[model samples]
Target: MADAPLNGIRIVELAGIGPGPFAGMMLADHGAEVIRIDRPGRGGITIDAKDPLLRSRRSVALDLKKPEAIAAVRRIVGQADGLIEGFRPGVTERLGLGPDVLLADNPRLVYGRMTGWGQTGPMAHEPGHDINYLAISGALHAFGRAGEKPTPPINMVADFGGGGMMLAFGMLAALLHVQRTGEGQVVDAAMTDGSALLMSMIWGFRGMGRWSDRRGENLLDTGAHFYDTFECRDGKWISLGAIEPQFYAEFRAVMGLDAPEWDRQMDPRSWGPLKAELERRFREKTRDEWVAAFAGHEVCFAPVLGFDDALADPHNRARGTFVEAGGVTQPAPAPRYSASATVAPTMAGERDDAGVLRDLGFAPQEIAALGH
Candidate 1:
């Protein structure tokens, strides 16, 4: 889409892996001009220009080891609305781009810092990953089956959802506040806090005594027969989410389970038997067959689709949730709007450092003098 929502806003993204880049990408997709400050040369890392996460941003490779590079970054920051970084607490301060220095130069700069344990606390200085953060936040413990070990959701919970998305939300909120008061603030986005916040509904259930501590023993976790996956004849799977009584009744009808035992729908004791029976019955037909059988039923059914299958799913195709760009098929910009348009992802190119510097208000002679 053209003329995105964040059209003229500029963001300086200190190029880092994981959540930092993700946050930058989110802003860029929504129309912010995100200038990614990458390291000069490959810098021991293989450059994948086709990576979807690197989209919708211009990049300038600058070696922070040089004094001129640091000066250049400060100059760029002078004109940026916000800056994002995901590093250890003291790393930025040591690099001479600390909050105090940058904020002093640009009082309206929104300094966004994303981390696993946050900027302070006992574990703040320690290095960790998505699983570590989720584990501490009680999110990981709430996943998977009752008797099985805790299973991480492929870094979705802590990394993208908790870290990047939380940072983006905080950045926007702070930006709004800055607009109102002309006072920018630091946005400390931590994965642990976000993961815990994401469990607000579950926490509410626990407080109301409707949630169980055991993994997968809760209502939405795979404890109930009607809210789980069933393996079919062809080894594929189908999911059911008929929680309400009426929906459960329809589900039972679609499954042809009219026995009196099926009447004990909400009883925990009946779940085991119902699950076993479902396992046996579901094996009688292929996943597609069951999908067709319950096509028009209010049974809340969907076949378990893999990545490739999902790319071809009718609903996904109809909504254009994914698109092909730069010869790569990836997810499209989401949470669509009627007034604001979402921009297509952009690929990183052979960066023109001098060009970027010039755009950042650097003179051509100054750019040439910077060893570009």
Candidate 2:
């Protein structure tokens, strides 16, 4: 919509993997005009621009190996409100598109840099992925079973949670600062820093002596049978998280556990036996049966669903959580507003060099000179 919060905002994206594209997607979802600069003749981790992360944007292939490409990027930056890139600390500098140079051309531009370690750490220039960044951030150490080795949560916590979302937030904040003070700055959004920040609640628990550093030994972890997934008779899984006494009472009543011995819910000794008994009971029914039994009760229950199931879920259908756009089935834009509902994502892999130049008020001859 024309009145969307970021309606008139413009962003230039230096195409990259994972977090970089996701951040740009977030901005573009909220009405930022994000134009991604794809590198010419380069192979990507995947050529699937239809992936949800790369949605809701336009693209232009630019070979930074050439001086003309660098000039083109600078020109776009000069007209943009923000720019996002996820290269190592000095890669953009080597390409002459560093924050110093870009900001010189556009003082109100928000230069957003995404990295794994950070810009000035000992490992700043090193190669790393989501798992490596999470390992160093201490967030990966708190997942999985009590005795098993630490298990990573498939890159969501670090990559999308810390890296991409954090960069998007930093870019927005910098843009707000520019609007207020007319000062542009570089937003150094590092996954390592953000992943650690994500663990702030766990760190608080540890500081208060309510949490153990051991993986899966905490209240929120799988330490409590009430807060974990259990296999059902149909080889399906259901999750329960009845942490409070009231919720547990509701669950106990619904399950018809009238035994007085099961009353000591908080005793660690009871937890093991209770878990075994519950496992046996859960095995007596399919996952759907358990979902039905807990439907009206406040047991904090849910059947574990796969991707396709999630898309077809009643709640998801009602909320329009997943949408079909550009021949892709993917998640819809988030944080709904009273007005200006999100636009459907578009397929993005076309080069419009002349149109881009024309947007910068270039004459016909100049636009023709800026060839693809």
Candidate 3:
């Protein structure tokens, strides 16, 4: 096993849905000793035996409604550096595992709370999903074609980005605070808040009058001809991200686009015609041919690859970006560190109660009692 960056950090994840497991996986990926507490009988939606994101972490199935489960969690929390939970507001408080109770026992434990809405809004208690959260966060509005109903970005916006990524970031930030002041704090990571934060760049663009709420009309939102995907000859697609003036010029030059007419780069009126012309040119070649042509160029071109294709790509294979573990091949750890690298383990299974408790400083007898 490689030396993990967060080997000394311990986290307890009270499992729910979506982002909770993802955030737990992120912490576990970086060498944090993350324990996922499942409420016995909670079946996961998808199970890939070799997926790397599921690596690391021990699981402990407990019924939080029971006194025994509550006590067990308290003991675990007492020794943990962080605790993450994704339940509707008040669920943890009702279980007696709330921030107030846990922080009282471990002043240095960062309590990370993940929710769709915020912690203190009128809609906090309302049932919602990724789509609902993104809708309210202004993310959905910035997606899809102009003057058309907004399309969902496959729940990636709220579930992973706003929910999981934000929770991880907030937990890390809180960990820094605990290290400084020895006082643990509650991290309210709401999907709505996170989604809005993800749009900070767009917000800045809007402030500078370079963006509009209408979708398919901005440089980054597929509104520009140079920053969108086009169909190729084989029915596959290729993405082009020649956003800057120099890159666009290089891209046009590579494709042999003529001057004067092609020089009208940022004109809104010329956008539709330019896109049509570019589409025609893109259709002349297969995705593979285009990839071969732009093998080493500043055109910022790539195939719109699916997951299976992504794993098989030459660049991905060369970099070992994906690994086979637990009979599955999934993405490897990211953001490599020079000194402390992440280790990729096989897919995790059900939580190992006795084994995990022993590692967390329980006596043999105590482990046996917990099993009972």
lDDT of 2 by residue, 1-372 (tens): 346678889999998999999899999999899988887653422246568898877776677887877988898899999999998999999999999899999999999999999899799999999999999999888888989998999989888999999999999998889989999999999999999999999899999988887777678888876888899999999998998999999989999988986788776657777888889999999999999999889889999999989998999999999898878898899978887856678766555655666666767875555453
Cα displacement (Å) at residue 205, model 1: 0.6
Q: Candidate 2, overall lDDT?
A: 0.86
Worst 10 residues of 2 by lDDT: 40-49
Q: Rank the candidates by TM-score, best first.
A: 1, 2, 3
Candidate 2 stretches greater than 4 Å from native: 42-47, 363-370
Model 3: lDDT to the true structure: 0.84
RMSD values for the candidates in order, in angstroms, are 1.6, 2.1, 2.4
Give the C-alpha miss distance for residue 354 in model 2, angstroms. Answer: 3.2
TM-score of each: 0.97, 0.95, 0.94
Residue 365, candidate 2: alpha-carbon lDDT? 74
lDDT of each: 0.90, 0.86, 0.84
Q: Supply candidate 1's per-residue lDDT for 357.
A: 84
Off by over 4 Å in 3: 42-53, 363-371
Extract clashing residue pairs from model 2. none
Better of 1 and 2 by TM-score: 1
Please give the ranking of all candidate structures by lDDT, highest first, separated by commas: 1, 2, 3
What RMSD does model 3 have? Answer: 2.4
